[model samples]
Target: MSETWFITDEQAAQQALEAWREATVVSAFQAHQALDDTGYIEAVETVIADPATTEKTRRAWNMAQEFRRMSPTVLELAAALELTAAQVDELFEYALTIEA
Candidate 1:
């Protein structure tokens, strides 16, 4: 037997994007230093392509991508994690600004 959410690629894309947007707004911690810029973004896109990326996990990944910058290093994470652009985007969301 098998199970599925029946979610389309477009829907997954939207959810993955939203996940990152939401994450950035809420996650206040400095990103995992190990994670390069675009690290989260690549992760989410990979999720969108993967069969295992559940809605719940995709949402979590989005939260992770938010507030992060876009950089070339995304490629490194992509290669290492075997992720896609959308999956990386899924890792994060919006972010609140801080006053210095």
Candidate 2:
């Protein structure tokens, strides 16, 4: 038997949102680097036209498109977590810093 650790629903939601934000930042950064190295539009067109593209590559390309359109925002997290306006504002401020 192993010990089980439990957290409040709010705590769990906050943790999940934080993890998602971190992942978004890292993914966006890597995607930006790749696009910058290869030429953004050209790289995306190449990736989409290539039949041999791996799932991971496709995912990165999709993320690049989304990031280019609008970097992921804390409003998304807030909606997913059902957070209050004040909490969302706080998270939004922190999220803005993640990419920088």
Clashes of each: 37, 0
Q: Can you write out model 1's per-residue Cα lDDT over 1-100, one digit (the tens) per residue?
A: 8886698999998987666544433232434322334355445366445766455544445455533334333334455477666555544322232211
Best by lDDT: 2
Error of 1 at 90 (Å): 0.8
Name the regions of candidate 1 deviating beyond 4 angstroms: 1-29, 33-69, 94-100
Question: Which parts of model 2 have CA positions greater than 4 angstroms off?
Answer: 1-30, 33-40, 63-100
TM-score of each: 0.28, 0.25
Candidate 1 backbone overlaps, count: 37
Error of 2 at 9 (Å): 49
Candidate 1: residue 34 Cα off by (Å)? 11
lDDT (10s digit) by residue, model 2, range 1-100: 9999989999999987666545543345544454445344364456555676555545555554334222333233234345576554443344345553
Worst 10 residues of 2 by lDDT: 68-77
Worst 10 residues of 1 by lDDT: 91-100
Report the alpha-carbon TM-score of model 1 versus the true structure. 0.28
